[model samples]
Target: MILCVLVFVLSSTTLSQQHLSHPINFCSMASTCIHDGRGVCASSPDGCSRRSFLDQCDMYEYNCDYGTQFMTKVSNPCTDGQPDFLC
Candidate 1:
């Protein structure tokens, strides 16, 4: 009886440790956004006059990573006009 109790305790502890070590990554499990094949054109009067992105997601990620907030979406793609920068 004592041996069985010790084994059970050890097994439970190991399982708890394993669970803690391998945490579920909710970010990876989250649904990913689908690309619509439409490019993003953003402009800012103060900063970059005009900029182009492959897609809206790329534009959003760039803003988030760069900590910029002035970029506004344009009605047309950058190819419509001469842009200052392209990505």
Candidate 2:
């Protein structure tokens, strides 16, 4: 039971890291209106080319400066064929 609990705790932490709520693709961003977030990487004010596997392939959020955290559970495959949609 202890082992199981420990494993669950560890896994949960890792999962959180992969699914933190925030803006993505900062490098390719075309806007800088975003304020900040867990996954938000200081906006470059250029919108964002950033992608991430923060949430499941289909289930994710688009937190543009926390104004709106859009969530979806489906996504088109990246042109580069990255599973996480990261270029």
Task: Work out the TM-score per prediction.
Answer: 0.42, 0.23
**Model 2 over residues 1-87: C-alpha lDDT tens digits?**
999999999989877655433455422241433433233222213323334333331112244343333333234222433233332
Tell me the lDDT of model 1 at 32.
52
40 Cα displacement, candidate 2 (Å): 17
Clashing pairs in 1: none
Clashes of each: 0, 16
Best by lDDT: 1
TM-score, prediction 1: 0.42
State the local distance difference test value for candidate 2. Answer: 0.38
Model 1 lDDT tens row, 1-87: 999999999889877653323343323322254556577778764544667777666655665566554344664466555445553
Give me the candidate number with maximum TM-score: 1
